[model samples]
Target: MIWDNNFAVSIFPILLQGLWVTVQITLLGTLLAAVLGLVFAVLRRLAIPVLSQVVSFLVVFVRGTPLLVQAYVAFFVLPAYGVSFNALTTGIVVIGVNYSAYMAEVYRSGIQGVPKGQWEAATALSLPGVRTWGRIILPQAIRTVVPMLGNYLIQMFKDSAVLSAITVVELMATAQAIGSSSFRYIEPLTLAALLFLAVSYPASRLVNRLERRYAPQH
Candidate 1:
């Protein structure tokens, strides 16, 4: 049934709309994740008395939980407490927050990966903390982690399909809707997989290049 040309034509445009939504969520969610993850890394690195402890606990909690459970709670549970976000906003926030824990670890690895001598030299020069981090540390740290962060962004893009569970009309959700109505899951589902593969395969290649390019030259 799916091999029918007209059905393919009708489905392509619809899938494109779903793809756009997926892209939007991935972009915004990645932005939030990058910023929040960096903040978490800093807080934990700083090790301030209470704040650091709190951040540590949060990172563990978020990482330990399932993303789907997190999403369901954000969408379904919060509204009962008079807290509510629309499905798009809810999906974006949950994805961002969920990924933040993992990114924070990536950032921490990057920060720790920096040569200790660089930190010691900055301190010997009497550089303020902000100046040391901004002018020296973050520049090197971010570069070291760029490939890793890029990989995570690709991962997040694929994971955005999970948001469809909450009524976000992303790629998988669109496919599900089409399948439900037409009682034909094959074409729509295959189209979604191909769309994901189209984006992710090239991205995987790019990440591989970045990893090689950034690999420490012994």
Candidate 2:
């Protein structure tokens, strides 16, 4: 029950290791989400009838479904179909895929928020589609959406703990395991909370600062 003996001696190391796993998953998953979401956003914006419809359906399905269910399906169901991934990989894929749907929407909104005049200006300049988007639209859209993307990153970080359900040994899972084994919940659970607070608080502040810095001036 003592704080010094239990927390500092036994629980800190285990929680620290778990935090590392959580950070790894969050970073990898966020990268995947960013890449895939941007692809989906661009595809949808292109308005290619069949391809657009297919991407729309995918985004809707992923966004409509629960992430935990996705995790379970990835880990438990995929093996029956001759596709199997390790728990950690499955967790990353599930989290990344789930968030990509939402991030796609975020990206689409950001892209669309660019004034129609910009697109027209690019067209009048005889810029190719790729060049126009790359040079004119994407830069502004990305700057506008950076804060939202950062918020998603923080959310992803917290949600990575859910990977423990599949035995991924992330932060929450490590705390649960250590607490159960040692029959001491206070120290491990407290350590996990502190770790989350330590990262999330600063990340949230950074997101706010980004939003302020990028806000369009009057």
Candidate 3:
């Protein structure tokens, strides 16, 4: 038979290990992206003379560049400048920062969607800027954008495969390694695709559910 079920069963455990690493990268990368994206969104919203413009430019630059190239720079070039991280660490950060540029726009849209009355009410209450944002504005803004963030989380999970190029032993990397060693690409590669679909399809459904749950009532 062309497909070897016994071999697939044997390699299942190893693939699971790589999947775990992929999950770690996705979770940590999304967390980092969420935090940094919020910071970027807030900085640009503040409209600080030069700072906001610089942040805006950086966001655009990151968005415009290819992620694979960025990963190469982080993995290869940064070490030359005395900035270095292990492959896994570099992958997580590069994915996070790459996603952050996109998330910043999502966050900006959320923040802008806040009711003008909310801002006026904050002013009338004499709330400090930080308190006004922390207490009133951000909570509402973040709620509206939660679904969008979840979508990005799903996207980053799939995109993590790109990090395999830099030797981060993710699912795709594991599959490739198995193929190279065994000269049998069919089972491992097919299994990897199935594994990805299994996770992403459910996650997308959950995101859709969240979108319905959080949508503003007419």
Candidate 4:
């Protein structure tokens, strides 16, 4: 038969195993991106003459480069300098750092969205710099940031497929391996695409809901 039901059924479990790895990469990468992005945003927001300029340039550089090249450097070149990690670890870190540049911009916008009155209030009360940001600025800023972060999470989930090139054995990689070994492409590839849609579609909807919920009132 052109499309073998039994073969597809047999490989479903294996594909799921790969899907789990993809999920792991997505979750860990998004977490890393969110934290690192905040750091980048804050550094820039501080507007320290040297530090802010350096951070801004680095963010721009990362945003300008292609993710595949970044992955290649991390997986292939870093080892010569003794900065090697396992394939999955390298993939997660590369993906996280790559997305961090974009997330930094998102965070900056959210931070800028905060009302000037809040800053004045903190200054008037003699709140420490750390406390002003930690208690007042970040909480209000993060409410706006949450929905954008969720959207990035979904994007990263889909982008995890690119890491398959580094031998991460994520869902796309698993499907490709199955196709190569069995010389059958349609079933596994189609199923993999379906699995991606299954997760991303719902996540997108949730992000929309969050955006509406957190949207600033006019």
Residue 179, model 4, lDDT: 98
**Global Cα RMSD, each model:** 1.4, 1.6, 0.9, 1.1
lDDT of 3 at 202: 100
Residue 24, model 1: lDDT of: 93
- Winning candidate number (TM-score): 3
What clash pairs does model 2 have? none
TM-score of each: 0.95, 0.94, 0.98, 0.97
Which scores greater on TM-score, model 2 or model 4?
A: 4
What would the per-residue lDDT of candidate 4 be over residues 34-152, giving only the tens digit for each residue? 99999999999999999999999999999999888899999999999999889999999999999999999999998899999999999999999999999999998888888899999
When 2 and 3 are scored with lDDT, the better candidate is: 3
Across residues 114-218, which tens digit of lDDT does each residue of candidate 3 receive? 999999999999999999999999998999889999999999999999999999999999999999999999999999999999999999999999999998542
* Candidate 1 minimal-lDDT segment of 10 residues: 1-10
Which candidate order results from sorting by TM-score in descending order?
A: 3, 4, 1, 2
lDDT of 1: 0.92
Instruction: Tell how far residue 22 is off in model 4, in angstroms.
Output: 0.5
Which one wins on lDDT?
Answer: 3
1-218 per-residue lDDT for model 1 (tens digits): 43666776799899999999998999999999999999999999999999999999999999999899999999999999999989999999999999999999989988898889889999999999999999988888888788888898899999999999999999999999998999878889999999999999999899999998987442
Quality of model 4 by C-alpha lDDT: 0.94
Which is the better candidate, 1 or 2, if ranked by lDDT? 1
Each model's lDDT: 0.92, 0.90, 0.96, 0.94
